[model samples]
Target chain A: MNLYDIATKLDASILTPKLDLSRQVHCAYGADLLSDVLAFTRPSTLLLTGLINIQVVRTAEMAELGGIVVVRGKPVHRSLQELACACKIPLLRTRMTMFESCGRLYQSGIKPCIKDPGCECNVCPSV
Target chain B: MSAPLCKKEFFVQEFDFEHAGKAASDMRKLLMDYGFDQQIVRRLAIAAYEAEMNMVIHGFGGTLIMEINFEYIELVAKDNGPGISDLKLAMQEGFSTASDEIREIGFGAGMGLPNIKRCVNFLGIETKPGQGTVVTMRVDLGPDAI
Candidate 1:
């Protein structure tokens, strides 16, 4: 789904510049653990989490995640937003809890990206 | 252009959770500029970030020294804090000593050291209780390795 569609579905607000909402989100990962997310998420997967910290942005950048959706109406701190902007990763906020957001996205046909064969260990997959 | 060999140092403050990943991010950029392959750079970045996180959350404070050469990139993180008493337990996938506060920040999942080991070619750890710990990680950058 596109960014616009995701924002509308989750009732999320864009915290970064309105760039090409046309970016394709092939998969979604809903987790607050940056390490798990880093270990699991494939490049370009949208990240859904309740954590609102600078490390989130840093993890997104390192993993080359497509975008980040903060759940439970969690506010994205300004510094994080700035980092997101600097990294060109979209940041959004939603009042919906993580479970609801994941369910909604799954119901909408977004699936988890295929895990890298190298990541078949105990690490959580980005699905 | 031929790849550039370089070394840089980063000082991580004790419990400075706010800026933990900055050093790794900077190092990643430097590796990119040195013309390292994207996959190599990404692996190095992940390893470096994990090491940096350990410094902030577990080591109390430390220095991360990174050296990038043509064949490999090496990260040496040294810290002065209560050291890891049981290396075997610490290397376990689900063993963590991080406080509740660190867990709340979405870390302390016990994957930091393991992930670093998984992403790099060589991983070494040295620790003395009440003194500190030093972790050395190397990522091979040759074509076959990538």
Candidate 2:
């Protein structure tokens, strides 16, 4: 689904609406670890994270993620909002917990970002 | 072996979470402005970012130098912090030395170096305990880059 659809389905409040909401996102990854998000996420995938630091936005920018949905009703700081806006990454906030948000998004047809079974990267044992 | 097409440097301060990824983001923008391949630019950006974050989280600040040549782009991150005593241990996926404060902000899960290695064409580390560390990452500008 597109970002706007996800926002509407989750009843999220858009923190950065200047970005194009019609951008399509094929997958989603929920993680609080910035490194894990960097390691596992695919390009243009949406990120559902609990962290509201500027690094979250920076990580999304570096990984080229579609957007960010800050879960758990956390207050997004002004710096985070400014960076998200400058990067043109859509930022959303929801009162729902990470699990609930993930479940709802999954029910709405958003696929999870997963490693390929045939992948050969041996660094992470979880892979 | 001629002069590079472009060269730039950025200073990263220790524990500077506020502006940690600026260098890497600037590098990505520079590559995009240079019209490099999007995939290659993305990979380089990830590598640079991981390196930048490492300096912020672990090291005592550093400088990031980028040299964009016709055939390749290289990023060298040097930090003057407590160097890694065990390079092998530090390279592991789930091993981290970051403090509780660092983890509170969603970092220190020990995926930085591996993520950098996963993104770049070549990765090199040089460190001296109690002195500093330097991470060199390179990505070629060709179809074989991955």
Candidate 3:
């Protein structure tokens, strides 16, 4: 799905709509642990996170994630927004819980960002 | 002719959450501008950011240096006093020494060093208790660098 579709499915408000929302996201990774996200996530994947901080944005930037969906309606810090804009990564906020957001996206055909046993993408550890 | 070795240094302050990953971001941009492969650039950026954050969260801040040659990209993060007491323990996954405050901001998961090691071609650490610590990470460039 694209960023706009994911936004609609989750009822999320785009915090950085000024940035492009037409990018395709084939996979999604949901995690609040910045370390885990950095370690396991793939490029251009959508990130579902509950945390809002500079590090979160930085994680998205370093990982080259396509977009971010903040769950549970957490108020995003201004610095986070500014950095998101600077990094050009779309930021979305949803009132739904992380579980709900993940479920809705998964049910809509968004695959989990899991590394299969036969995967050779050295970044992610074997499942 | 081989490209000249390029180097840049950034100073990170302890608890400076405001600009924690600036160095890493800047280094990534520099490497990209130099025409490095996307995969190599991303791997170097991840390792650089982890090293930079390690200084901000664990040590008394430090200087992060990025050196790029035709063959490899190297990142050297040197921090001030309060070095690692046990290198072996620090290298293990899920072995962070960060406090509650750091954890609340979505860091300190004890995966920094391991993450760096995974992203880089070589990882090295030198520390002296009550002195300081230096972490050196390198990612090779070329066809098989990825």
Candidate 4:
């Protein structure tokens, strides 16, 4: 699914719609730990995280992920929004908790990182 | 290695989460602008970002230097923060000295150094208690690099 679809499905708020949301999200990753996200995430995977910070944007860019969905109804700071705007990484906000968002996306047909085909345990569920 | 095509430096201030990843992002832009291998460039960017954040979250403040050439890219991150007390312990995954504030900012899970080591080809560490620490990392441009 594309970012728009995910947003609609989750009823998320688009914090930085100016950033590109054209790219398709093949997989989904949900984690609060930036370290785990950076370590395990693959390019084009949509990050569903509760942790919102500038590093989240930096991590998305470095990991080559599609975008970030900040869960838990947390208010995204302007700095975070600005960074996403500058970097052109799409940012979404959702009232749904982390687990709920991940489950919704996973059931929507998004998979885990396709880089490792052998493991289909849905660990992070990337495409 | 041949003279670096370009060398750039960035200052990272302790507890400066606001501008933490600027230098690393700059390095990414530089590498991409040079048309280096995409995967290699991503790895370098990750290393750079992790190193840059480490200095900001753990140290008082520091500088990041990027030296780039066709053969490789080297990143040096030096900080005036408390040096690692145990190199071996610090290198282990999930080991962290980050304060609660840092963690609240979405870092300090004890993965910064280890993550950098994972992404780079070479890693070095120099430190003294209460003095400072320096981390040197290198990522080789593969044979396919133009």
Please report the candidate that would top DockQ against the real structure: 3
Error of 4 at B140 (Å): 0.7
What DockQ score does model 2 reach against the true complex? 0.65
TM-score of each: 0.90, 0.93, 0.95, 0.92
Q: Put down candidate 2 lDDT per residue, B33-56, tens digits, no spaces.
A: 877877788888888998888888
- Candidate 3 chain A: minimum summed lDDT over ten consecutive residues — where? A118-127
Off by over 4 Å in 1: A116-127, B1-4, B144-146
Candidate 2 colliding pairs: none
**Top of the candidates by TM-score:** 3
Cα lDDT tens digits for candidate 1, A23-111: 98989988888888778776788999989988899998887789999999976678988889888899989999999999999999998
- Candidate with better lDDT, 2 vs 4: 2
Q: Which digits, one per residue and each the tens of the lDDT, describe model 3 over residues B1-146? A: 57648879988999899899998999888877877778888898899899889899888899999887777888899999599999999999988889999988888899899999999889999999999999999887877543
TM-score of 2: 0.93
Per-residue lDDT tens digits of candidate 2, residues A1-127?
A: 8988999888999999788889998889999998888888878889999998888999999888999999988999888898999999999999999999999999989988876577654222233
User: Distance from true position, residue A67, model 4, in Å?
Assistant: 0.7
Per-residue lDDT, model 1, residue A69, is 94
Error of 4 at B79 (Å): 1.5
Put the candidates in TM-score order, highest first: 3, 2, 4, 1
Give all candidate RMSDs, comma-separated. 3.2, 2.5, 2.1, 3.2
Runs in model 3 lying further than 4 Å from the true structure: A116-121, B1-4, B144-146
DockQ of each: 0.57, 0.65, 0.87, 0.52
The better candidate by DockQ, 1 or 2, is 2
Docking class of 1: medium
lDDT of 1 by residue, B1-146 (tens): 45546779988888887888988898888877877777677778888888889998888889999987667788999988899999999999889999999999889999888888877889999999998999999887777443
What is the clash tally of candidate 3? 1
